[model samples]
Target: MWIEGAKQAGVEAHPWDNLAEEPLPTSVEIEGTTVPVKWLPKPELGESGGDLRNVVFVYESAEPHLRLRWQWQARGDFGPVEHRITIENLGGQEVWLLMVDSLRLDWKVTPTQNLRNVYVEKGADSPSAEGTHLETVSDGYNWKGKSSTYAHPVKDEKREIIPAEIVCDSNGNGWYAGVEFSGRTRISLERNGTSLKSVLGLDPEPGPFKTRLGPGETFETPTVFLGAFRGGPDGAGNQLRPWVRAVLGNPVTWKDPQYPLMVNNSWGSGMQVDEPLALKMIGESKELGLEMFHVDAGWFRGVGDWYSEPKKFPHGLAFIADAAHREGLRFGIWTDWTQAALDTESGALNVRDPKVSDWLVTDLKPDWKPEDFKGQTIDIGVPEAHDWAAKEVKRIVEDYHLDMLEHDGYLVAQGCVQTDHPHGPPNRSTMRVIHDWASDFVLASNSTDVSYHAVRAYYDIYEKTRREHPGLLFEICNDGSRMVDFGSAAHGDYFSITDTYDPLSNRRAFYDTSHLLPAAMLESYVEKWPVPKPENFLYMLRSGMMGWITIMTDTTAWTPEQHEAARKAFELYKAQLRPFIRDAQMFHISARPDGVHWDGLEYWDATRGKGVVYAFRGSIPDEAGHHFILAGLQANKHYRLHFEDGSQPDHEVSGSELLGQGLSVRLWNPLSSELVFLDEVAARK
Candidate 1:
């Protein structure tokens, strides 16, 4: 009967099938002996968030005397299941544990004459590297791998890309799984003839290679997420999106009334921004209805120097912050807190410096000489150094009265190897400490008891900073989305998708990132490229409307007529796209850009009975326009449709006809675009 039940729940056939009656195998090595653990017969179930169910299962092995309390939570009938594992030593003896698997599940398969198709989709850690790739697996093979490890800043340039999430679609059904950890994680999928098995766990090596847990000592694994969908790969991928967002616990939402349309000074002036140019940009930004004004880079003394440049801001950064605040706009500045400049006044020591050898991790290979360190990176794993960073952050926040801090150069310490710090020895494990610090700094938490001391110290800094400045926001920019992950999303409010201004690349990024993140959390900036012609410039603006819109250009170079037109485009975006971006479900009509052709996306709010579709044309002269079947609407409802450009007359049509027939969009010229708005009107009698 238990075997039959397991089969119904997607369990595959295996030699240990009879063990279906037992809980998933969880073991611990104690005193040189491996001990098998058994789960308590009944799970403790309770209610959470009114509709969610929480199940707690305690697994233990009396011989080794350890307990692992597993907490499985289901948000609703359709939501994914999230679980976390916590292991505690119950006996009065020390236990040398080697591994901990947070989750293990078997997927059932039906026998067929031909090999079944299993499709997998994976994502990378960086924004420039963010996109889904499809892979097919057949019988008699196993796909095993660990997540990415950036041994050097440019390692990704040479390494084969790995997926952040491993989703599989087989037999008309889909299954999705991803680790919520920002650190190293392990994932595996195996198919043998008729059975499939999937597993997720932390990468335990180097330091935790042998965790000696004394009596009462506890260790917790990062949360793992798993879900199954009846739809295909797209459905499976979409199902994980909301689940990931929920797990991150980010407070900022699309519905936030105060969300800003930010204007950045990077594209126009470069990194050499001065107070006069900043003040001029602020004045123009206000006239253009920009809610936030940010000075990107160049304001500080150098990379690690958080203080304002005395020459650029003779009166100090507080003056600029106050001026923006008085103009009713939020102020922000950019800085890279992760690394110090080689020529800065601090004379900070980089991780590869021989003088800081005692303060670095041990992962620095013996063969690699100190001269190989190419950039400045301070090892924040040291208590004194970590504290100093925290104080510096607080000083800037209070001294400038800043509302947002855009952090760049996060990968500066990707290769640090000093292991003499308090956390643990210098090894690959030390990288996890740095990653956790970056995560904690962006996401402020009230929890006092984090599992790791290094992580807790960073969290404490953010927590206190938040208390002092309640409305502060953190934007994570790691040399163009290198650090984008669930952990960063949890801590930071928004992410700059890419720093490049190429329209085609930016368009592809928009389509790809919108799949994994909400439109509000993804900010796309319009570059000052292609000479900013009216037609192409408007196309760039519309392309970025799917996410938060950022205009990066020089107002001083614009003519009076150009300024008027730019202001009108910004107004139209604020009126027509902002609500849809905030509340509607995004549908990627074209996930990739086809050279010199049409690529687009749609945003629809079914509950509100309204939506918008954005269509674009490439640079090919012969390519005129494209037709896309609009999605996410009530088929039977009558709707009013019109183009934002006013080239087409407003007309009435039923949603069914529109969905069945399709919406045809024609641009006025090559490399142009159009915006179509749909609203449900009175039903035809």
Candidate 2:
């Protein structure tokens, strides 16, 4: 299990060799097993004609979960030649994989060994205390540190080195995703947990030179490392296969110690407190171990302005925050800082002080005054504008002792006018003006509370805000699952796969997408929006328990069944919180493109020890044994399977039977899934 020059099975050693060309196709001997190694023509070299084939060398390790890698070019004629190394394995055990932490161009290799001079938190007075790439000689292999986006300028500069990166047993359990670009070349990685993975070729390349393989029996751990030059998809297919397999094979684990999922109330204007309804919901949420209760929109009468309507609650807005605190649940309020109703009846339109006149809530037309204003947008960039906002919002937060802010609606402000009064130039695009306004608002308001925001539209705007606030959990809702793609997910905490679907039917799609992209995606929604349904809430709460869950119901409209489901869902949610946040690994079991019976697997707390398995069925209006495979299981373990009672019947199966046997099964029940738990087993084999 050890390497010839290293003490551990996971050590990597690359001693720079001055030799021009060792041999045509050499071999790297590791643990007494030699892997074939050779170099091909690097496409980056612009070869008029030659082998055109890049280099590839793979070594079989003695350990069940290891592979050795090495690559270099022998064409001495191409001075300053840069060779790309890529590996692919389609097997049960994963290889300890890592990329070269440097950029090689024009024969000059620049290591990501020094990042202190490259990264800086944009506005920090002191040298930003952000994570930077620092080179280390561990196990004799030089390693570079990975930098979080917050600490860098992020200009997408060429030839510039990116920060270091690492995927450990804790960070990436089942699969991982990352992007690497150095002014000229870019590499992206996406690992599928199992089956039909590939590795690609980069140099001397017009297209990817792929290697497709799997375990001795069936393909498991489909990994891919998509490589590209100048950052495009020309070489994607080749790199994608191996990259996915490598990630799937890597160890899966995380540390989610506390389970604290809970039910929430958020609806249109969404969460206007009825005092009585608020009190009941808060108490129920607490009784069910729900740690948080979010009071979504409608509490404030003004959109751009922040103030609670005493008439709506009668007891005062502070009463609800206080009630939530008394019940030991964290309290959150929604804020759409960008738009304001200009209607004269709205509380937001009366601020006309001459000094702050530029911040006036004027409509596009003169007849559109606050009292009678319709569809008027506020200009937040004028210093006085945000000044007005902060005073009102701070009062609410301070008085309520709020724990989180559900920030929403910045995208709606992009095209609104900022008035011709005086803040720089007039007629500026709403996009530019609003960006400045939003950034200022977040910076001016700092109470050390957790805040969540919505980036419903506009990808670029969401990315900008994300860069500014890494701790902030941002949700991207493109209205439905069709918009749920890789491009949108790279920048947010979770993607609400589908909106406003009946939970029982829609949960399958949510689980399927979560299974497809676990590392970078999660399921979410404002449960029961537009209408309240127990089945919808139940399904959403169940799915959310495994990942990210949000609920939006008319507290006043809950039926007896809805109430019970809410209570139980809150409990299950709390139980799943720790795992959901930690090692939430998902492996796909089945995918029904026709919306028939969808199947997938999700395991929370896979990294930090004990875990729970979640399986789901698509819409089924018949009786049939719905069957699917389970993943993230130990070969020697015993598992007991449970369903959602009326949702499905209970069942049991051995982990060895579901995953180790290389066999698939079916159930007579329709549109349902089985939740499996292992009672006893040895450490992972």
Q: Estimate each model's TM-score.
A: 0.80, 0.50
Task: Give one digit per residue, the lDDT tens place, for model 2 in 1-685.
Answer: 1012121212133222121222232433323354544435334533222332234344433333233333432222111122333334434642222122222211111233211111111111111122122222122232222211111223432211122122212112111122221111122222222111112111111111111122341111111121121111111211222222233211221111232234365552244456776787787666555666777666766544466766777877778888887877767666655445442353454434343334432323333333211223345434455455545445555666665554443222212233342221222222222222212121111000100001122233444444443333444442233233333334444444444444443444443443234433344544554224444344345554555565665544666676676676555555543444334444444442223554444453444444454555455766244455555566666554544343344455566786755323343444434444433333455
Measured on C-alpha atoms, candidate 2 has an lDDT of 0.37
Number of clashing residue pairs, candidate 2: 53
Q: By TM-score, how accurate is candidate 1?
A: 0.80
**Model 2: per-residue Cα lDDT at residue 491:** 42
Which stretches of model 2 miss by more than 4 angstroms?
1-260, 266-272, 287-289, 343-363, 367-393, 411-498, 504-523, 529-540, 555-562, 576-581, 592-595, 604-610, 634-656, 660-673, 683-685
lDDT measured at residue 270 in model 1 versus the true structure, 0 to 100 = 74
On a 0 to 100 scale, what is the lDDT of residue 320 in model 1?
Answer: 91
Pick the TM-score winner.
Answer: 1
List the lowest-lDDT window of 10 residues for candidate 2: 444-453
Local distance difference test, candidate 1 = 0.59
lDDT of each: 0.59, 0.37
Position 660, candidate 1: lDDT: 81
